[model samples]
Structures are given as structure tokens and as C-alpha cells.
Target chain A: MKVVGLYEYLPIEAQESFLDVIVDTPKASGHDLLVRIQAISVNPVDTKLRASKVTVEETPRILGWDAVGIVTEIGDAVELFQVGDAVYYAGDVTRPGSYAEFQLVDEHLVGAKPINLSIEEAAAMPLTLITAWEALFDRIRINPDADAGKKLLIINGSGGVGSIATQLAVWAGLEVITTASRDETITWSKQQGATHVINHRKPLLPQLKALDLEGVEYILCLHNTDAYWDAMQEIILPQGHICSVVELQNPVSMSLIKDKSVTVSYEFMFTRSKYNTDDKVRQHDILTKATQLFEKGFLKTTLNHVLTPINAATIKEAHRMLESGKSIGKLVVKGFEENDEQAN
Target chain B: MKVVGLYEYLPIEAQESFLDVIVDTPKASGHDLLVRIQAISVNPVDTKLRASKVTVEETPRILGWDAVGIVTEIGDAVELFQVGDAVYYAGDVTRPGSYAEFQLVDEHLVGAKPINLSIEEAAAMPLTLITAWEALFDRIRINPDADAGKKLLIINGSGGVGSIATQLAVWAGLEVITTASRDETITWSKQQGATHVINHRKPLLPQLKALDLEGVEYILCLHNTDAYWDAMQEIILPQGHICSVVELQNPVSMSLIKDKSVTVSYEFMFTRSKYNTDDKVRQHDILTKATQLFEKGFLKTTLNHVLTPINAATIKEAHRMLESGKSIGKLVVKGFEENDEQAN
Candidate 1:
């Protein structure tokens, strides 16, 4: 199988950062499904894992999480999917990822792809869709019925996770207030169903106040958590909830939220797969629901950029764009290069 | 009205730390109720507020929260209670508290006292009951039916809030594992229906492992949050919830729970009342339900010590015991002194 992989961690600019290589195709067993990659998306996690540490791997390390693919084979215990099924998923972070022509994924984590969308469009939805879904419904536990008219503040609403989160929040009947600094990003945020767009570069509280909102009932922070921690504390209503996808780099004074009786949660999309929790199948359920929403026209794909002929060069370019911190929405790489396509 | 109040913040041992003085009786208006105090209980909040700062007050500031009293008057807008109704409440912290012969409380914060319990017993319950109830049912949002048989760890099993939390968790059909060091506290924890009693003085993970338990689904931290932050993270199940009433004195690394996708919340009993939130009336509903549970023998008051004559001297003694950190259950003071009785 043709794969884009790395032997050692290096800057994206380096020629050896990512390499095109031939690896033996893996077999599906137990609950696993052998998926032929159709398209894969680059997220912050891809770039982060690519350059996180300085260690040489004995074998090439694959580094993609989000993918839209066709199941070519199914394991003995697999019941959710069968061969020839088009599926989409944010695969497990602990094992080999979706950076290869043939990738193995647990059947419990794979969802039927939205038939209405193209391969690249479906690939862009999985990781961000799963993250945004879990952050709001699972971690923060917002009720669509009970909290219908309540306000939700999505920080960095033009980012990958934020773009999907704004749409989900609005679809759940919440009034979405999102943050975006640049004109393009602000317009992008509005396009994603944000009811109001504030500038993240300015003080968030003043911007929210200008929108006639005293505080939000919920906050989904998709940016630097440490930088926005204090502002979130100030702008969250008493007894409100805050869910962040970003990890804090420094110790924070948690007591600041005590008087308001606030709930703060972290939504690491990989937690279920990494912990091997009993409810790991929930990822499949979330993606299936997302597919329905997309097909029903309640949701639209956040794919903003696409590169053809998936190879080391294209993957590196996607990583470089993500690392630049200026990329809007999701970037996807589709199809194996014609020369490498035969290796699959 | 005769009240135990302070002009300035001082240590419990100081001569003028608390003074019995005659103040004009207050009137009930809006959602307020004027109650004639029968008994008042001391909590850690009483001691913490008494010496929190060293600013002189223009008027004497009374300090107490939990009270069992008879409603002597009701405001025009008060519909929850009528005059002469025996009520119990953890009144608003921003208002003058129950350390007086006559106290005014928001009707929404008051509940009909349990007919089965004595005044001092009922007085011992309100504050801690509200704290524990809010931590479990509101903050953690544990569903009794769905989460039945799941484990919940209470950090301090013998203290006021811990005692009730243990009982509540048990009543909700959860397996309660609580922390207690001394033999007396351990026995007391068992009395409160704790399934297991572990020592908080030692590392909690090893103790839990000794019982063949890997982790708990929920943790209610009643002790120091900063000290237990790491242990809570280590001992919580993936996607578990943790609620704490203790405020952290120092900044702590919150990102430690990111990998587990843990939800951490602060449950301040005063939040609704302090913020004047629309859901302030939820406290009344909780206390009303608690009263029924007590009357039905599903719950019991945790009063372990009592002082006669609600006066400055008794209040000082109560504060001293709470600040010493060795007091078990709850300490309550009953009635006004004969000499001070005429003031009301």
C-alpha cells in the first residue's frame, strides 16, 4: 500500500519531514475494517503529532485521523459495516491512522458516509464534527429542547472545530455568538449559522455586551484556552458551562469560577478511543447522526481547500498551511497518485 | 431584635469577635419572609466569612446561613410560605443571616421543615444538604436511574457536606466510596450508608486499587480541591464527572484531565441567591423534597453537637470548633438567652 509517513520528527519545511513509501497492507480482524482511503483531512492534531517530539521510529509512522473511505474488508465480529460500504470516521489516535491506501479501523468507530456529499467534503466533517458534537452534547450536556433559546459563545468560530460547532449549536436551536477577527473569517462564521460575530482580538466581554448579551449560558472555546480563560470566566453566566478543545499550557486559578458554580470540561476527541471506553461506539453514532444532518440540509461541509493526488508533498503542504494558523475551515487531500495507485 | 454580629473581622478567640446587640426588627417585603429563629447551625462558611477580611462595618454584620425558624411575617409577593409556618433554609449570603432572633429571608430560599426532626436537627441540614444536592444532581447531573450502581467517591465522608452527600448518593442507588481517617469518622461514614471507607490521609489511588477498583464514575470533593486535584484526575473514569465545593487556594493544572475528558464543576450553594438567578427557586424545591425524604426516613440530620442559647458566646464557640477542623457532622445553637429574649 502507498502511504505518506515519517521516520523522524522534523519541521514541515524539511524534505524528509514526510515521505512516500510502500508498506504491506494490513488485514482486518476482530471488529476492525480494512478501508481503502478515498480522501483524508489535515487537522491541527496531524501537524502537532508530526512535530511533537524528536524520536526516530523503526518503521514509518502514519499521521492522519480524519478520513472518508470505502470498506474493502470487514472483521469477523463486525456488524455495523460490510465490504463496499462508503464510510467516514476520525480513527483511533493510539494505533496506525488513516494516512495509507488501506487502513484498519474498528467497525464501532466508522459511520456510513453522507451520500449527498463528495469524498473530500465527507472527509472534512468527521474529526471536527465529532469534536463539536461531543463538546456540546456530551461534555457540556446541553439539551436541545430545554436550552433551545439559550446563548452559546463559540470562540474562534471560523476554525475547523468552531465552524462545525457554530452550525451544530444553531441547529440545536441555540442562539450562536461566535468570535472572528478578520473580515473573511467573520463572513465565514456567519455562513456557518452564527447569529452574532465578535472580534477575538478585542476584549470578548465588551463585544458580547455590545450585542446586548450580559453573559452566555455556554462557551465552546476552540482557540488558546489559557489566553481566553479569564475572559470566559467573566462572560459565562452564573452556573454556566464551558467546554474547550484546546489544552491549557499553564496552571490556571480554577477557584475564579467557584463563586459562579461553573462547570469546565475538556473535549479531547481521542479520549474514547485512547481509553477504550465501553461507549467507544458513540463515535459511530455521532458520525451517523452528522451524516443524516448533512443529507437533510441542516449541515454543510466545512471543507475550504482540497489537494488532489494524495502524496507526501500534498500532505506536507496541508500540514504547513495548518501550522501557519491562518487556514480557514478544513483542508483535505484526495486520491492516491497514479503511479502509487497500483500499489494499493 | 437580638443578634450576634461583628463590627470588624476578628479571630474567634478575640473578646469582641462577636457581640450580642439590639437591632431594629426588619420587615418582610417583595419575596421576603420575616422569621423568628428557633435554632441556627454553624458551617465552615460561617467561620470563613467571620475572619475573611479586616474591614470595619458601618453597621453590625450578622453571620450565619442555616436556620430552622417560624415564619412570623410574609411579603405581598411571597407565595411559598405563610405566617406561622415552620421553615428551614440556607438563606442568601448577601443578606443578614440567622445569627439573629429575627431574620429576613427570600421566600424562594425557604422550605417547610421536616415534621419528624427537631429544630436543631433541621437547622443542621439546610446548608450542607443544599451543597451536596446541588453538587450531585445539578452540577454532575447524574441520572439516578441510568447511573444506578455506579460508584461515587466523596473526599471527606464524616464532614457535614460529605455525610449528606454519602447518604444522597446511596439513596440515588450509587455505590458510595467515601474518605475518612479516624476510627470514629470511618464508623460515621458507614452510618451514613457509604459502601466503602477509604483513608484520605494516604494516596487515594492505592487505597482504591486495594479494593480492586480502578476508578470511580463520579467524585464529590468536600475537602481541599488543590490537594485532591491530581488524585481526582487519576482516579476518575474516562468521561466521568467531578464536583467540588472546596475552593482552590492556589492555581492548579486543569489540563491533567484532558486526556480523560473529565468534567470538573464547582458547586457553590450561594450561586443562585448571590446572582439572583431565575432558578433561585430550585433551592426551595430541593429543600421541600429533602423534607419529604427526612419525614419518610430516607434521610437523617447530621447534627453531632449542640450549644444552648443562641448568643455571641455560643456563636464564638461554634466558630472555634469549625475552624479547628476536628468537628464532626454539624454544630448547632438553639434559642436566644433569657436576658436577650425581650429584644425580639
Candidate 2:
């Protein structure tokens, strides 16, 4: 199998940062499905993992999480999927990822791909969609009927997860208030169904007050949590909820939220797969529901850029673009290079 | 009206720490209900407020929250209770508290006292009951049927809030695991229907493992949050919920729970009343439900100590006991001294 992987961590500008290599194809076992990669997307998690690497790998380390693929084989224990099934998933972060022509994923984490969308389009939705879905529905558990017309503030609403989260919150009947600094980002946020767009570069409370919103019932923060902690505390309604995907780099004074009786949760998409929790199969269910929404034209693919002929060079370029922190929506790499098979 | 209050912050040993003084009786307005106090309980909040006071008040500052009283008057807008109704409540912190002979409370924050319990017994319940109920049912929102048999760890199971929380969790069909160090506390926790009692003074993980548990799905931390932060992170199951009433005095690394995707909430009982939230009336509903539980014999009064003839001297003694940190269950004070009226 042809794979884009790394033996040592290096900057994207270095020629050895990513390598085109050959590895023996792995077989499906237990509840695993052997998927032939069709397309994969680059996310902040990819760059973070790469940059945080401190140990040299004995073997090439694969590092792609979001993928749209065809299941070529399925283990006997797999009941959710079969061979030839087109599936999409944010693969497990603890195991070998989807930076290869073939990869293995647990059937519990794979969902039937939306038949209406292109492979690159479906690939772009998994990681960010799963993150947004779990952060809003699973963690915050916002109810559509009871919480309809309630305000939800999505921080960094132009980013990958924020774009999907804003749409989902709007779809769930919430009043979506999102933050963006630049004109392009603000337009992008509004295009995703945000009812109001405020500049993140400015004081959030003043912006919210200018819009006549005293506080938000829910806040989904996709940017720097440490930077937004105080603002979130100030603007969250008493007994409100805040879910953040970003990890805080420094110790925060959590007591600031005590007087308001606030709830703060972290939404790490990998928790289920990493812990092998009893509800791990819920990921598949969420993706399946997302697929239905996509097919019904309620959701649009977030893919903004795509590169063909998936190879070390293309994957490195995707990583570079993501690391620049200016990329909008999602970036995907599709199709394995024909010459890469000869290397295998 | 006779009230036991303070004009200045002083040590419990000081004669002026608490003073029995007379103030003009207040009239009810808006949602307010004027109640004549029958019994009042001293909680940690009373002691903390006394210690933290810096400004000498021109008007005496009353320091009591939990009360069982008779509704002597009702404002025009008050519909929850009428004159002569026996009610119990954790009065608003922003208002003059229950220390006075007559106190005005929002009718929405008051509840019909349990007919099955005595005034002293009911007085011991309000503050801790509201805190526990809000933490479990409102903040964590643990479903009785869905979460039946799931483990809940209460960090200080024999304290006021923990005692009630343990009973409530048990009544909801959850397996209640609690922490207590003293033999008396352990016995008291067991009486509250805790399935297991561990020592908070010792390491928690080993004790839980010995009890054949790897982690708990829920934790109600009733003690120092900064002290237990790391242990709570280590013992909480992935996607678990933790609610704490204690405010952190020092900054703690909250990112430690990110990998497990945990939800951490602060459950301040004063939140609704302090913020005047839309759901402020939920406190009335919670106390009403608790009243039904007490009537049905599903719950018991946690009051274990009582002081007679409510006065400045008695309040000072109660504060001294609570500040000692070894007082078990709840300490309540009942009745006004015969000579105190002359002083007033």
C-alpha cells in the first residue's frame, strides 16, 4: 500500500517532513473495516500532532483523521458495514490514520457516506462535523424546542468547526451569534446562517450589548480558550453553558464562573475512541444523521480547497496551509498518485 | 423586629461579632412575602460571610439563609403563598436574610414546609437542599431511569449538601459513593443511603479501585475544589459530569480533564436569586418536590444539633462550631430569647 507518513518530525519546508513509502496492506479483523482511501481533509489537530511530536518513530507515523473511503473488506464481527460500502469517518486518533491508500477503521466509528456529495466534499465534513455535532448536541445537549430563540455564540465562526457549528445551531432553531474579524470571515459566517456577526478582535461584551443581547445561553469556542475565558464568563447567561474545543495553555481561574453557576465542558472528539467508551457507536449514529441532512440539502459541504494526487508533497502543502492559520473552511487531498503504487 | 446581626467583622470570640438589634419591620412588595421566622439554621455561608465582611454597616447586616417561617404578609404579585402558610426557603443573599424576626423573601423562592418535619428540622434543609437539588437535577441533569445504577461520588458525603445529595442520588436509583474520614461521618454517610463510603483524607483512586470501580460517571464535589481537582480528573470516567459547590481559591490546570472530555459545573445556590434569572422559580419547584419526598419518608432531615433562644450569643456559638470544620450534619437555632425583645 502507498502511504504518506513521517519517520521524524520536521518543518513542512524540509524535504524529509513527509515521505512516500510502501507498507504491507493490513487486513480487517474483529469489528474493523479495511477502507480504500478516496479523500482526506487537513485540520488543526493534524498540525498540532505533527508539531508536538517529540520522539522519533521506529516506523513511519501516519497522521490523517478525516476520510471518505470505500470499505473493501469487513471483519466477521462487523454488522454496521459491508464490503463495497462507501463510508466516511473521523478515524481514531490513537491508531494508524488514513494517510494511506488503505486504512483500517472500527465499523462503530464509520458512517455511510452521503450519496449526494462528492468524495472530497464528504471528506471535509467528518472531522469538523463530528466535532461540532458532539460539542453542541452531546456535550451541551441543546434542545431545539425548549431552547428555540435562545442565543448561541460561536467564537471563531469562520474556522472549520465553527462554520459547521453555526449552521447546526441555526438548523436547531437557535439564534446564532458568531464572531469574525475580517470582512471575508464575517461574510463566510453569515453565509453559514449566523443571525449576527461580531468582530472577535473587539471586546465581545460591547459588541453583544450593541446588538441588544445581554448574554448568550450557550457559547461554542473554537479558538484560543485562554484568551476568551474572561469574555465568555462575562457574556454567558447565569446558569448557561460553554463548550470549548481548544485546550488552555495556562491555568485559568475557574472560580470566575462560580457566581453564575456556569457549566464549562471540553469537546475532544477523540474521547470516545481513545477510551473505548460504551457510547462509542454514537459517533457512527451522528455521522449517519449528518449524511441524511446533507442528502436532504440542509447542509452544504465545507470544502473550500482540494488538491489531487494524494502524496507526501500534497499532504505537506495542506499541512503548511493549515499551519498558516489563514485557511478558510476545509482543505482536502484526493486520489493516490499512480506512480506511488510502483513504490509499494 | 428583633434581629441578630453584625455591624463589623470580628472573630467569633468577640462580644461584638454578633449583636441583637431592632430594625423597622419591612413591608412586602412585588413578589415578596413577609415571613415571621420560627427557626433558622447556621450554615458555612453564615460563617464565611461574617469572616469576609470588611465594611462596618450603618444598618445591621443580618447573616442567615435557611429558615422555616410563617407567611405573615404577601405582596400583590405573590401567588405561590398566602398569609399564615408555613414555608421554608433559602432566602436571597442580596436581601436581608432570615436572621430577623420578620424577613421578606420572593414568593418564588419559598416552598411549603414539609408537614412531616418540625420547624428546626425543616430549617436545616433549605439552603443545603437547594444546593444539592440544583447540582444533581438541574446542573448534571441525571435521569433517574437512564442513569439508574450508575455510580456518583460525593466528595464530602457527611456534610450538609453531601448528606442531601447522597439521599437524592440514591432515591433517583443511582449508586451513591461518598467520602468521609471520621467514624461518625462514615456512619452518617451510610445512614444517608450511600452505597460505599471512602476516606477523603486519603487517596481516592486506590479506594475506588478496591471497591471494584475504575471511575465514576458523576461526581458531586462538596469540598475544596482546588484540593480535589487532580483527583477528580483522574477518577472521572470519559464524558462524565462533575458539579462542585466549592469555589477554587487558587488557579488550577483545567486542561487536565480535556482528554476525557469532562463537563465541570459550579452549583452556587444563590445563582438564580442573585441573577434574577428566568428560571428563578425552579428553586420553588425543587423545594416543593423535596417537600413531597420528605412527606413520603424517602428523605430525612439532616439536622443533628440545635441551639435554643436565637440571639447574638447563640449565633456566635453556631458560627464558632461551623468554623471549627468538625461540626456534623447541620446546626440549627430556634426561638427568640425572652429578654432579647427588651433589648430590641
Candidate 3:
């Protein structure tokens, strides 16, 4: 199969950054399903991984996490899926990823694509939706049913993950307070179910006090976790919890949380697949529920920019938009160009 | 009323570290209860608070938290107890503590003392039991129904709080593994309720691995948190949660928990009283339940040593033993010498 893989960690401008190469696409085995790639989404993780210090691999390493695809073959042990099934997943973090014509993914991590949406639309939801879902429900352990009046503040509401998070929290019946700096993004955040929007560039306490809330019960941080650490610490209710998806470059003081008996949790969407955890099948469950919500029109597709005839030119354009730090929901590259569609 | 207050953060040998003073004991108002103090337990938290710098207060501040006494009067809004009720409590962190002949406490924070144990034994329980109960059932959020087969590791077993937490975890049917270094502590920990005892001073992962375990499902850190950051990260199960009560002097890396989606909570027992939270009555409820458990002999007092004729001499002895870090379980101080015979 024709695959996008890298031999070295290089800057995006480098000639050999990501190359089109021919590699053997393996047959489905165990619980794996061989997926014929349809659409793929680029996230910040893809760029960060490309710049990591890990040395060049003996074989070219494919790096893509989010993809919407169709199953062409099914493994003998797979009970959840079969051939000809349309699927969407944020695939395994340790093994090969989803940047290819054909890929192998565990059936437990794959979810059926929403019938109401196209492949590019479905591809954008898996990684960010899964992350936002687990951050609120699992990591922060919000009781959406019993505590409908509880307040949640989603920091960085205009970003890829935050857009989905704000909608999901509102759908679950919690009042949503989100942070957005730009006027357009602030207006967009309100449109996407945020009850109130604050500027992330400023301090949060005075804003919360103005909202007639002394503090919130939970905080979901999507961007610049270390920068918002102390602010979240002070505004979180005593015994409240905070969850963050962004990785911090520096240490976070454990003291900031200890006095109030608060908890801090990290929600990484790839954890289940990375560790091959026992409850890995739950990802499939979550995606199925998310699909139901989407089909019922409770959720809208977060795809904002779509580049067609997925060639090196269009892929590089999507990557640059992401690198610029101003990309709003998601940038998707769909349908491989005929010239680069050579199979292995 | 007679009070024990400290004018400065002085060494134990300073003779004037704790002084006897006379103050006008305020009448009960709002939810406050006026209690005539009898016996008290000295915890490490008390010592730490006494030694802490106090630049804001011009006068000597009363410093104590845990006590068993008789309720003399109740405020207009106090509904939990009546006059002459034998009570035990750990008062609020922000107010004058239980270090005086007559101390005022929120009625919701006090509980009916156990009918079976003596006052000294009851005094030793509140601060530690509250910390233990919240850490296991609330912060770690263990459902007794769901936690039956899970492995739980409690660091620093046989300490003030650990002794009760191990017992409570065992009662919840979790397979309890606790850490203790000394021979006596190991035996005491097993007697208290640990199913397995590992030396905390040694590397914990190899020890856990030797037991045919990759990691534990939960870790309750009752020791120094900064020192055990790496080991706690390594020994925690994928998607596992951890809770700690110790405060770290420096920032600890939050990224250690990022990849696994692990959560870390700080279980400060004083949060409810300090914040006047809506759930303050739960402390009264928990203590009432604890009293029942004690009367039925299902719970055991951690009080291992006692000093009579509560005065500067005996209090200093207790402080020295605590600073030595070799004292086991709890050290309690009884009523003043002249009142001892009248108390009985």
C-alpha cells in the first residue's frame, strides 16, 4: 500500500519530512480489521510527534491517529465488525497509525460512521470527541444526571477539542462557561452551546464572580494547562476536580490543589490503545453513543475546512493551518489523488 | 476560659512554645456549639500548624484540632446536638481550635462520642478517620459493590490515618496491600487489615511485580508525595486513580499521569469546615457511624500511648515523640491534673 511515513524527525519545511512510500499492508488477524482509508484529520499531536527526538526508524513509520475508513477484511476473532463495514476510529498509538491506503485497527476501537454524515465529517469527531467525553464523564466524574445544576468551565473553547467539549457538556445538562479570546471565536463558542464565554487571555476569577458564581465545580482545560494552573486552582470549589488534555512542559505544583482537597486528572484519548487496557472496548461503546447523538442532531460536525484530492500540496496546506495556531474546528484531507494512489 | 496558645513558632524545647492563657469564651451563635473540653489527641497536623510562621496575628493563637468533650450549649441554628451531649470533633481549620477549656465548634462538625471507648480513644479518631473515610470512599470514589476484587495500595500504613484507612478498605472488600518499613509496624498493619505488607523504603515496582502484579488499581498516598512521585506513577494501573494528603514543597510533574488518564486527588479532611461547604453535615453523619462501629467493636482505636495530667511537661513529651517520627499510632493527653479526679 502507498503510505505516508518518515525516516527522520524533521521540520515541516524539510524535503524529507513526510514521504510517500510503498509498504506491505498486512492481512487482518486476531481482533484486527483491515480498513481502507477514506478520510484523515490532522491534529497538533501529529506535528509534535514529527518534531520529537526519537531517532529514525529502520523502517519508515506511518503517523496518523484520526481516520474514517471502510473495512475490507475482518479477522477471525473479530466479533464487532465484518468486511464492507464503514468505520471511524482514533487508532493505536504504539503501532502503525492511519496515514495509508490500508490500515489494521483493533475492532474494539472502531466505531460505525454516522449514517447522516460523510467520511470527512466522521473523521473529525473520534479523537476530540473521545477526549472530551472521557475528560468530563470519566476523569472528572461529573454526575450529569443528578447534578444538572453543576457548572463547568471549559478553558480554550474555540480550539478543536474545546468546540466538541462545550457542546457535549451542554448536551449532558450542565451549564457551560467557556473561554475564547477573539470576537469571532467568542461568538462561535456561544453558537456551539456555551452558556457564557470569557476571554482566555485574562484572569478567570473576576469573570466567574461577575457570573454570580464564586467558583465552578469542574474545569476542563484544553490549551496551555500550566498557564491556567493557578487560576483554575483558586476558582475550583473546595473538593472540586480539574481535568486537562494538554501536556505541560513544566512541573505543576501539587500544593495548589492540596489545600482545597481538589483533584487533577489528565485525559489522553490514546491511553486505552497505547496501553492495550482491559476496557479498551469502551471506546467503541462511546463512539457508538456519540454516533447516536449525532444522528439525532444533538451534535453537529466540527469539520470547518475541507481539502479535496488529497495530494502533498493539500496535505501540506492543512498542516500549515494547524501550525499557525488559528485553525478553528478541524482540517480534513480526503480522497487520494490518482497520481499518488499506487498500491503495494 | 483557660486556653493553650502559642506566641511564636518555637522549638519544642523553648518552654514557652505552648502557654496557658485566659480569654473570654464567646457565646454560641449561628451553628456553633459551646463544648467543655475533656481529652484531646495530638496529631502531626497540629504540630505542623504550631511550627508554621504566623506574621498576621499580633496575639497568641490557640492551636489544636481533635477533641472529645461535653456540649454545654447550642447556638440558635444548631440542630444536630443538644446540651449535655457527649461529643467528639475535629474543628474548622480557620477558627479557634479545640485547645481551650471551653471551645466553640459548628454543630454539624461534631458527632456523638462512642459509648464503649473512653474519651481519649474517641479523641484520637476524628481527624484521622475523617481523612481516611474521604480518601477511600469519596475521593478515590470506591463503591463497595464495585471494589471487591480490586487491588488497593495504601502507602504509609500504621500512621495516624493509614491505620483506619486500611481497615476501611478491607471492610469494603478490596484486596488491601499496604507499605510499612519497621517490623512492628508491619505486624500492626496486618492486624489492622492489610492483606499484604511491602517495605515502603525499598523500590515498590519490583515488589509488586514479584507478587505477579503489573500495577495496583488505586494508591492512597499518606506519606511525602514529592519523594514518591516516580514510584506512584510506575505502580499505578492504567486508568487508575490516586489520592494523597501530604503537601509537597515543590512542583511535581503532572505529565506523569497524562498518558494513562490517571487521576490524583488531595484528601484534606479540613476542607468542609474551612469552606463551610453544604456537605458539612456529612462529617457529623460519618462520626455518628464511626461511633456505632466502635461500640460494636468493628472499629478499633489507633490510640497506642497516653499521658495523664495534661500540661506543658506531658505535651512537650508528646511533641518530642512525634518529632522523633518513631511514635506508633496516637498519643493522647487527658484533662488537667487538678480536674483529673473530678473527671472520673
In terms of DockQ, the best-performing candidate is 1
Question: By DockQ, is 1 or 2 better?
Answer: 1
Q: lDDT by residue for model 3 over B227-293, one digit each (tens)?
A: 8888999999888999999866666666668988998899999898888899989899989988888
Query: Candidate 3: what's its TM-score on chain B?
Result: 0.95
lDDT string for model 2 (B177-290, tens) is 999999999999999999899999899999999999999999999999989999999999999999999877776776668999999899999999999998899999999999
Encode model 1's per-residue lDDT on B198-309: one tens digit a residue.
Answer: 9999999999999999999999999988899899989999999999998777766666588889998999999999999999999999999999999999999999998989
Q: Per-prediction DockQ, in order?
A: 0.76, 0.75, 0.72
**Between 2 and 3, whose TM-score is larger?**
2
- How accurate locally is residue A313 in candidate 3, as Cα lDDT from 0 to 100? 58
Per-residue lDDT of A1-344 in model 1, one digit per residue for the tens?
Answer: 99999998999999899999999999999999999998899899888888757799999999999998889998999999989999999999989888889899998888999999988899998999999999999999889989999999999999999999999999999999999899999999999999899989999998888888899999999889999999998999999999998877776666659999999999999999999999999999999899899999999999999997789999989898899999889998888876335322
Candidate 3 segments whose C-alpha is farther than 4 A from its true place? A52-54, A338-344, B52-59
lDDT of 3 by residue, A1-344 (tens): 87778888877777777788889988999999999888888888888788856697889888888888889999999999989888899888787877788889999998999999888899888888888888988888777777697899999887788899888998989999999889888987887899999888888999989989999989999988889988999899999989988766676666658878998898999899889898999999999999999999999888888876554556656777889988788888776665234210
Q: How well does candidate 2 match the true structure in TM-score terms?
A: 0.98
Model 3 DockQ class: medium
Candidate 1 TM-score over all chains jointly? 0.98
* Model 3 chain B weakest lDDT span, ten residues long: B51-60
In candidate 1, stretches whose alpha carbon ends up further than 4 angstroms from where it belongs are A339-344, B339-344
Instruction: List native contact recovery per candidate, as a fraction of 1.
Output: 0.86, 0.83, 0.84
* lDDT score, candidate 1: 0.91
